[model samples]
Target: MTLRSEFGREGNVWLMPGGSLLSAALAAALVVVGWDVVQLASEEALARAAKEIGPTGRLVLIADTQGRLPDPRAALAGRPRPFVVAVGAGGAFSTLADVVERRVAAAVLDADRPFADLVAALDSLLRSTPVAHDANRLVARLRQREDEARRFFGLTPREQHVLGALIAGRSAAEIAVANQVSMPTVRSHIRAVLTKLGVSSQLAAVALAHRSCREPTLLERMREVHQL
Candidate 1:
């Protein structure tokens, strides 16, 4: 028999025997577990948001860091709300525009001069860009796809509810209000969903919820039932 086929993730390779039922079952189980992890990651993102918004009172840190970060959580840290994107390498890292939708707590400009002056200037241009609203139109369109989630996704009811709220563009605070859970708990659930989906970034998770946006956010289609 040929050796098990190989699949790799995060630098580790998994070899599973193709013809064995046991191997297939294990593989499927692993996939589900992996998705579960993605969901956890999403909730963690919300926690990161809360921390950023919270006080130690808050400070906008400056340095050559936090861009192209592999983990979204690490990407955001200590750099206060209104980001000051200064000149950097070749590209302008417009981190400041991140939460423009919400009023920025504050902005701090870099006083030190840099070689990449042009790049820093680009950040100024980006900061001026208007904030966009969190539109629920996509959630409305994604309702039909819920069944596929139920049938193929095997997500727990709690997972579905948390995901549904996210698709509707509700913040973790909003979800906490609706679900009666503390904001931190809601954030945890969000992280779980991201981990399960194997995605980073809230927008990506929302896009997945749109799932070929021909459907609706699960709750919209579920009707008469409410979920956190």
Candidate 2:
């Protein structure tokens, strides 16, 4: 039988029985399969957690290598209105110091942590009174600002549509094409929007528009039509 040596500690090689070689190969294969199973299970757990959390929130895994989180104002702009939770090691948390300072919805330390711990943390965050209060206050303020903006700008229906496109970061040319209008007409509408909003630049106009264009709640709509 051919003898094979297994490398161990420095300058140490142990000779194994020829039968043991086959066993070793089987063990290696088992280890690889076990690792793959663990990875798949982790992914599935995270997926289930995300699904349970629903679209109203998100969990962001932060790492030391991650440079910076996007501005929440810009990042949280659209529908589903998800709250953000940051999870990572202490060093990772330090990297997101600014985000923490801004009081993100939640933060959980992840170094050597269990997956269950993360889900529990998320659940706790969702149940926290302070988090709910802050969210409600934010929504109320956004609605108030939207009301003020609509009243102050006094934009016509066409101008409102143009403004929406502009806020979506559409270029004048793209807006023209999308609206099936000439470049000159688009530019004219853009200028009119800027003038009405009292902003000189497109960026400023877009910024102001974003500050004001939240989807109106039913109560807000009722108030708008004076039915409330």
TM-score of 1: 0.29
lDDT of 2 by residue, 29-50 (tens): 3233221101111223434343
Where model 1 places Cα greater than 4 Å from the true spot, the runs are 1-152, 212-228
lDDT score, candidate 1, position 4:
30
Q: What is the lDDT of residue 196 in candidate 1?
A: 74
Query: In lDDT terms, how accurate is model 1?
Result: 0.39
Q: How many backbone collisions does model 2 have?
A: 0
Candidate 2: the clashing residue pairs are none
